[model samples]
Target: MKGFESEMIQRLRTSDGWKFFGVLPQANRGLAVTWWVLLLLRGILPALFAIVIGRLVGAVQRGQDVVGPLALVGAVYLPLQILAPLHRAIGANLGSQTAAWLYDRLVLACVRPPGMGHLENPKLTNDLTMARDFDLGISGPPMSISMDFIASGLVEMIVGLASAAILVGYAWWAPLLLAGGWLATHWLLRESAVWRDRNTEEVRDAQRHADYAYRLAVEPFAAKELRLFGLADWTVDRFRSMRSRLVELRFQATKLRERPVLWSLLIVLIANIVVLGSMASAAADGSLALDRLVTYASAAVTTGMIAFGGLSWALDCSAAPVAAVLRLKEAMEPAGALVLGRQPADGLPAREIRFRNLTFTYPGTDQPVLEGFDLTIPAGTSLAIVGQNGAGKTTLAKLLCRLYDPQSGGIEIDGVDLRTIDLDAWRSRVTAVFQDFIRFELPLRDNVAPGGAPDDFIQSALADAGAAGLADLDTVLARGYEGGTDLSGGQWQRVALARALCAVRLGAGLVLLDEPTAQLDVRGEAEIFERILAATRQTTTILISHRFSTVRHADRICVLEAGRVVELGTHDALMAAGGRYHTMFVLQASRFGTEDTEEEGVNYDVLT
Candidate 1:
């Protein structure tokens, strides 16, 4: 019995359900204090009402005035009814405040780090999903609704204990026997009453599937594809199937067992019969006073409130997110942290940039994407990198932006190691337009110059990307807003280029363009490449593309094969050598004619 008591105490201390109590004070101290004070008053009101009713009965029996006893009943009952709504209103405000606080901490945990690896890590996915979507009422009720249920349930438990304490005035053993039987229900039916297993990976996976299917049905991003594929009914079926699986898993974890339910019923029934029978016998024999019997009988009924109930479920749903948010706050920081450097990066790369003996692999992969690679690029020149798919073309741009550090070797800007420069300072000196560039749902001016620039400068940059006539400066880029218009794929590409150009105008020295013109046609790509080259003449520019026709115009062309530089020279020089670069260029050029070219087991049709 002692060991059991110790274990129960330990579980209570470590339980996630109680963590929200600590969060209440942190969310708002004054509100938290007031909430506790009201709970105390509300919890003991039932016991006080029982005592006052006994006095009123005795006053009428003795033929005395009952006004004082009647007034006392009103005093206890009035506050009991009034405090509930007032407490609920306060709890609603606290719930909203707590949600905002959690989000603020969650955002900082994700974005405060300088590296992107943590966002891509698979291990953190479950916690991230729970913390991100908890307030949306996907897995359970929203926090505001849960808070009200939690308050009511807690008050019920407190009322039971207070009433049981009042029973001690009649017989010490009476309170112990009644309280023990009701409290035992929590232990016997613990699994069925609590949803503590909701954070398990199996449950989290089920939730993710259900949420994804729901999103596919409701979100606008997948609306076109669903209708085009005749999948409206299919999507609904999938959502229902996934939601059914989720419910099955949760029920399996929390289902009630027959043995435990039977045991609780037997114990509670035996205790109630013994206590009420003893009281009736004593009153009949005139051993117990009428007023005392009345008070004890009422107290015995109220003590049933301590049984296993809704508080367990409501507390589990509400407190799990609080614990998840706090866990993420501690875990995400070290997971995504990067080493810092204090060196100034102003006016860097005046001479050249070099990659020496570099070897790198992605975070969770074994195969190296860039192995023993070596490259050198003189400042103020345009170099085009051409490679087959998965030959590390885009990886090069990510490295240049310092999104991830190499496991071996290093990249040098001029003569300084890139890692030795301040991360923010180095980023300010570089600009990029990735293949999957962000198209913010904002005004054209904000899209072009996200960091803010003068009107004339933004206009000049827009003209350089052939985007000056696309839309007015203040027009929003998304179709969802009134008076806003969406752009065509080609037009959006030009706006992305204009954004890079704006960054360059703000004193960026290095420019990385990763498939920047992939959306444009051949003629449009050729036209845009000319503008890119002319506008970025004074910066060290790198371009990653599959188009040999466009790359041939660069100051120098590089051919990467199997994560190594196989050929590097001017377009005419590499063609003269008749090596890998020469063969690829000729094969791609051959496809311009009427027939598809197939040579050396390679089909130019698939390549194009």
Candidate 2:
């Protein structure tokens, strides 16, 4: 019992536990005070009822008027029935508001970091899962439920003392024996709670796997493949396998807990037998009056009921979740922390942007994605990067957009290192549309004008991106909304392009279009690239694609292979050299029976 108390104190002293307590007053001080007051009343109510019952029994046994004692019992029971509903309603409201407050902080803690490093960490991902599982409302933080348990425990202690005083008239040792029995029961119950807390991590991991399998089976994105590939039964089997393991572990824990509970029950039985037997013996010997006998028996039974009922269960249920909350909070703290820079990037690059010996590797992997890579783009010029898959073309764009920092060396905009500029201010000047762009489930206007551009600006961007006939501005692009509809892959691509154009309209200076025309047809691809060149004529643009014909329009083209630039020049120069780029371009143009000559610029109309 002493060890258990020490553990509880240590858990409460943890940073997350302290924050949990801190949120109560911060959410609403007046409401917190009221909640505490209600807890006090709830705690005392049980003892008050026990006392009233004892008094009424004494009055009836004495053959005196029992109306006063009966009315006192009514006074306690009637108000309690009314207050129970009120208490629950208020508690529910408080839990909801507190959950919102905590959830907001949790989201910011996960997302406010400057890079995607933490998001890629498995440990942080697990912590995030646990934090989300034990959210507010009925399954809220331990402190919320602990208040009721604390109140109940206090009430039981008070009632035990009063019962002991009444029983002392029978024998001085009687109260001591009863108190010892209750203490033993409490200790056993607390041991079970401790065991549960110790094993929660393993159980939570199993549940997460089970939940993931279920989501894969039910989520819309996987539905088509699940049916066509006949994977529904396989997914169901996986879910069942995980669930069965979780259930087996839980059953074993429950069986282990039953032994301590059996010991607690034995203690209760012995204590009750001794006290009741002594009371009957005294009554038969004519030493104890009938009224005193009734009063003592009632008080003893009430004390035992209070000791083992709601209070014990509450203690057991609240312990594990509170500990989990604390663990998750500590695990989710950002490692290096997000610090703001004093220097602001207020305008476009005046000279040039340079990547100086940049080296990088993704988290958890030793293989370098970009190794001593070097490149430069003059301001207001178009640069096209052509490469096969896994050439680190996309990685360079990610580094430039500051989604990650390089392992060594750095990128410089104008004369300042990218890291020294304010992150948000720098990001605001860059706009990108990757091959795997987002298709927002919103109105067409919202999708095209993601930066909240004016309607005229949205229409202009749409026209520039060649998406004016895709949908009306007011048309919803997803189901669940009134008059909502879905779009084809090509149409969604056009809308994404329009979103990027809208960003450009809103003052973004660095434009990146990575395989932006991959989903478009031959004619559509040519038209969109022409429009893009015209639109970004005054901005620094980097285009990545595998098609040589589309990249021929850029001011310069670079070929990347295995994380390094192997060739850099114009289309005509690369073709004349007949090197790696010339071989790929010839191979691609050969399929369409088009010669790689300077006169006809490799006709792309038939390539798609």
Candidate 3:
């Protein structure tokens, strides 16, 4: 006991060390008060009943009076017994509720958080995972400990003192013996808590193993691949190995905990044996009456409850970091405060959208994905960006839509720094649909209205996106769910298009489309390109595609490679120059529609 206490005192310095002590006070404050009030009945009434039993036996032996004492004990015992479960039940409900509140806060902190890119940080990710599981497992233990610790410790102390007081008549060492036993239990609890803290990571690892094994037992996505590739054995083996390693670590910690636990148990056993013998001797010697002897025995026996409860509290106090992690989340999240609403007025229209030596690299990335690239797109005009993989084609569209800010240089919308403007209002003015788009398992209306546009507005946008057939969303979407069906690739593409168009109709000034028809069939692709061309008439458009045929509808073409614009002009002008655009155009034209390369420039009078 002295050794363990010394170790804790030594460790009470660092942040982790501080938390162990700090959490003790924080957790105990109000809960300790409530627990103390509740635990009064657990020990007090039990001792009183034992006294009554002793009196009843004395009355039988002595032929005096026991009824008053027995009746008085019953009056207290019945109410205490009734209230025990009620208190426990209340703690149980509180445990579950606290867990739920923490879980909500944790998930919201991740999903709806400021610093949107924090998950990329390894430290934060590990903490988030720890906090999530903490909510799942920590609630019951701590709540039980808080309530029971006060109840059991108080009662046991009273009982142990009273019994020792009785045994004081026989030997002076009796009180010391009982105190040693009770204190030994507290020592064991302290040792167990220490090991639990030391092996916190190990417990998490074990749970991960169990969780991975459980996922293998269910989860639809893994089913096909697991069976087809015959990876089930490998997965099962992985799960087994992980589980075994975790169990081994925990077992090691548990082994370290054994000596203290054994010592406490041994102490209790010795105390009981000594207590029984001494009381018997006293009764035989007529130093105590038989009824009083029975009452003392009963009271001594009930001391175990107090000891058990106190032990539980001590051990649980060690691992309360699990709860602290949850509390951190509840405190760290912004709570939708400091969230400024949309800019009160509309933004200035984009004039010459300029990238003045703009440089950008993704979060945590090693190198710049875009470097010192300068370009301009005129207002009320369409620009087609063409490039091979990793040539920064899609990145341009992302930048144009302000999904990320440039790292070193700046982007100016009509010469206004995008960073200076309200981001919410800026986003509202632009819309985008990327190649890797979300396929929502929702009704057709919801699919088209992912931005939550009005119903009539969604219908109008769907018509514009060549999705009039899916406008009566409820029946069409419900049919798919009922029949275990989903929209075909072409059908889903149209739905996404509808969503984009809906955003456009909601007053988006710029619409960025990255590989808009990549999943569409040839006919669907043609139809989609025509609708996109029509869309450009209403909004300035930036198109990214590998298919050169799609650029015929674009008013201008810009060839990009390694994040720099190498060529810029109308389709005909670029083709006449016989550059990368010309070669790619001829290649795609040969594959799709007839390729036309001989031209000075596109006729300016087509739309006019």
How does each model score on TM-score?
A: 0.92, 0.83, 0.73
Against the reference, the lDDT scores of all candidates come to: 0.85, 0.73, 0.64
Stretches of candidate 1 above 4 Å error? 1-14, 190-194, 258-260, 308-310, 582-592, 595-608
> Can you give the lDDT of residue 557 in candidate 2?
94
Provide C-alpha RMSD values for all models, in order: 3.4, 4.6, 7.1
Off by over 4 Å in 2: 1-8, 15-25, 133-176, 179-200, 257-262, 286-289, 305-339, 364-367, 386-391, 547-549, 575-608
> Residue 371's C-alpha lDDT in candidate 2?
92
Full ranking by TM-score: 1, 2, 3
Give the lDDT ranking, best first.
1, 2, 3
How well is each residue in 1-608 modelled by candidate 1, as lDDT tens digits?
Answer: 99999999898777777677888888888888987888778788988999999998889888899999999989988998899999899888888888888888889988987877667767778778888998998878887787788888878888889999998988899889999998887556656344667657898889989999999999999999999999999999999999999999888777775346888899999999999889999999999888888999999999988884336677777787788888888877777766678888898778999999999887667899999999999999999998889999888998999888888999999888898989999999999999999999999999999889998989999999988788999999999999899999999999999999999999999999998988887677777889989988999999988876677789999999889999999999999999988888777757655343222212232242
- lDDT score of residue 57 within candidate 2: 80
Candidate 3 — which residues are off by over 4 angstroms?
1-40, 43-48, 55-64, 130-176, 182-190, 195-217, 257-292, 305-307, 310-349, 356-375, 383-407, 434-442, 450-454, 475-486, 514-518, 544-608
Candidate 2 has an lDDT of 0.73
